[model samples]
Target chain A: MNIMTPTPPSKGRVDVDNFALSYDTLEGPVEAVSNASIHVNPGEFVSIVGPSGCGKSTLLNAVAGFLKPTRGGVTVDGEPIDGPGADRGMVFQQYSLFPWKTVKGNVEFGLKMKHLDKSSRDRAARTLLGLAGLTAFENKYPDSLSGGMKQRVGIVRALATGPKVLLLDEPFGALDAQTRVIMQQILTNMWQRLKISVLFVTHDIDEAIFLSDRVYCMTARPGSIKAEITIPLERPRHQSMMMSSEFLGLRRGLMSLIREESIKAMGGELNDLALDGLSIDLHGQSLADVL
Target chain B: MKVETFALRREQQTATGPEIGAETSHVRTVQSPAGAPPQLAAYLRRWLALNRRGLRAVLIGAISLALFLLAWHLLTENRVVFFIRFTNVPSPSAVYESLTRAMQDSTFFTHVVLSCRRILFGFSLAALIAVPLGLVMGRFRVAHEILFPVMEVLRPIPAIAWVPMAIMLWPTNEQSIIYITFLGSFFPILVNTLHGMSLVDPVLVRAAQCLGAREVSIFREVYFPASLPHIFTGLTVGMGVAWVSLIAAEMISGQFGIGYFTWEAYSLVQYADIALGMICIGVLGLGSSALIRGLGRLVMPWNRT
Candidate 1:
């Protein structure tokens, strides 16, 4: 994955070109992301892995059209994204399902918004909920469900409108490890079945490596794309693949990438610390010096 | 042979094992008797569980009323040191007798009906106007800025203070009393509805927008439902205030109503009728508030869990 080589953009591909986003605070304009660029081809699964405060979420928000980039633009399917559109759906980490709506009602929401009649809305909700194995709990409120179940409903609700791209901001970040793994499998299955583009944001290195076609590592604030690594694993990934050598290699690579950014962000001297058989330092030089 | 048969049955039961297990773990199911139909027994169990709480509440309430009655009897019987304020207050039995006598009088029905009508009309008018205004004020900054300061100034002036203005504004005494009642209830409902609308989760709004909901739909689906619990709180508080204003207005401008009856009784020095009037107002207020709470629970099923 060469940083200099641009991904071949196609129709329905999400492209962020030289994207820089900032927030206007009382103190000053604080830079969140700077000159960050990434692209996801149609039906490709991409994950952005970074340290805390690396602006991974800010970048994803820019894609979701919740926030406008200060410098660059985000284009989806060859069109500039002006605001939140139905074609780009989002799943949040907090399982932002409307608590007032039942599981079926939450899933039916997009269709209802699309002005689909009651029967078709019910059919669509039933189909999606059944696919997610949430049929039994259709009438249950979100507060009564497990965190994993709620997140599944969140996913279905996002997918209910049949969006072209799914922007997931740490969708499984709040789940327990076991549930997180199960949810990952469920997501993988859904993505495979639907063939939708995904731009997942996460701090978990293993999650990024396990779920993504390519993992993009981001530096700390003012954040920029640091590296991109291709995942050579085959699709329809299994839980057992986590123990394989290639998976472990990718995991180790992403962990170190995140660690370097985290230390640099902390203003740590980055003097040679004991790591996995590698001595690296970024004392006075830039992130590229060590990479 | 018997053991083999048992194992065969177990295997048959578990043929749909994984799916059944998943379903059971995911859905909270109540266990019921296997052979017999559990509908009757289930209904009975639920009914009993529900009424167990109700029964406890009723028992405690009855005991409390009895204690109050006994204390009232003792105090007015002129037997207690605390009762010796050269007591002119009527005894509990005397009040009870007056209540019975009033129940027999047809004028009592007129008084009760008139008071209830005024409360219902005034409260409905207040809610009709305030709820939409509050929602608009809360959603838009400019509307809030223009209206909130005015509301703050008006909210402090007690409903009793509005009686003179209401009398001057309306031609009839009935209209004036209703106006005063409306003024009393409008602020609580308005303030509460605004609070609820403002406190709606920003995350939910963003999620709704991303899910293809337009602004109008978002307000209808997300903001409206989100504000319901708070609206119910406002309704309950507003109902109470409506009753207070109604009584004050009725007392000030009299023809009929429990408030007028109570004031008339006080002037006539019939302390027993005064006590009865107070009791009637208390009972009606308690009932209405309870009804509002029940409605709130019905509307918000998620809040129950």
Candidate 2:
């Protein structure tokens, strides 16, 4: 079988134009995303940033073709998204490596599915294990890895098949603050090297600012893109930039937008704003009203 | 700084004074209680209650056995119970002697072999059939739907109910006994197997899916290994059931088995021998169940919880 036969010309590029998603819980169809559109050019790193439960993960899954939008569509290259396939790889927050297989075996999994020869698969697995900074730990099981290390292997396992694009669902959300920063650096280095089209979903605002070439800021429930902030900072950026004035300005503006939306999300509450010690005197109107 | 300083000096003097008044206020005489051994004895009582299942079991078993033996002794020695003749019953020491005499004869080993052979055969058969069927039922909805109802119907029926049916169908004594034992143990194995297989983490399935494991191979490689703990559970339960059913079947009809021997001694009014056989059966049942429990621990080494 030909590996590249009939692959759509724009297969590496993903476009979700006017996409709307809803989930039916015990109550009713909860509208998650509406008229949300984002473009991820091939080999670009983009992050979707929002509050928890703002449908960022649902959107990622929609792109992964695990869920269908109620309206609009997601297309890769020029092909309409249908269902999950080998071409798209997903790394979940929990590092869902099969417990029964070792890290090496987990990385070798996709190649095994392709029925690759043992020697070749072993060689490729070794390379991926090294790329993930888990070379010596390949034979170790996922249960033994730290949260950061586990996510590394999770990312590596997804990349094992050489999927053109990678989908990360809160990929480092479960790690401790210190460990999370380290993982972010490790992932940033790994992504720069791999150059795979990455669409990362995260709730951490700072993480979004740090990793994304362009960050799509989303609102509360019934989510939509409130703003798209482009990082003009140079590539191969370091942690030192995180404390710079330019970084702080972007951070402050993004946080203000988030806080205003959060207040609006609670239905324009008056109590927190009216408490005597803390004054809310920004033009003497609610933040949402001003917006 | 004048009167306030004088008040501060007074407070400091009081604070610096001895704290003995606070210390001795709550004391009481714990020595007043009858048979109380003081502080160390109280600690010993607390320790025993807080931990020690063996102590609990021993206390309960001792009380139960005392009541049982007292009743037995009364019924036979005082001739209180009308159903059994005084001659048909024996004192506890007489029964003990009969147990020793039976041990000396050494014919009991044959009976033990007969029962164990039947149980092992049936239990193994049940495991063979139930484990695979259960794996299928757990993995495939169609298989579960087709077989689940049939098993539910058969599960409630007692093993003794199948005896007449087994007699007619198998046409051999040992085959019929094995059949009854197999039927008795089969349902627990099947149900536990299905429970174990289905209880596998769905996240594991998804992980395997995203990792590119194909359908049949996925079940073989992932689902099967994950279900091992449950499979072992079924086997252990089946082992116990097989023992229970085999003995019950032997008691109902057998020329030579521990169960049959008990029944024969009962008819001949060898009361001591009958008591001795009952004790043997009880001990064997306990010993076998312990063995299965040991096997369970070996299989699930990660089950610290």
DockQ for the candidates, in order: 0.69, 0.25
TM-score of 1: 0.87
* Top TM-score model: 1
Top lDDT hit: 1
Q: Which stretches of candidate 1 lie over 4 Å from their true place?
A: A1-11, A268-291, B1-57, B79-86
Q: After aligning candidate 2 to the native by TM-score, how far in Å is the CA of B145 from where it should be?
A: 3.9
Instruction: List clashing residue pairs in candidate 2.
Output: A10-A77
| TM-scores, all models, native as reference | 0.87, 0.73
Query: Stretches of candidate 2 above 4 Å error?
Result: A1-11, A23-30, A264-291, B1-110, B261-305
Tens-digit per-residue lDDT, B138-236, candidate 1: 899999999999999999999999888887899999999988888889999999999999899999999999988998999899998999888889999
- Which ten residues in a row are the worst by lDDT in model 2 chain A? A1-10
Candidate 1 global Cα RMSD: 8.3
lDDT by residue (B44-80, candidate 2, tens digit) is 7777887789888999999999999887887777766
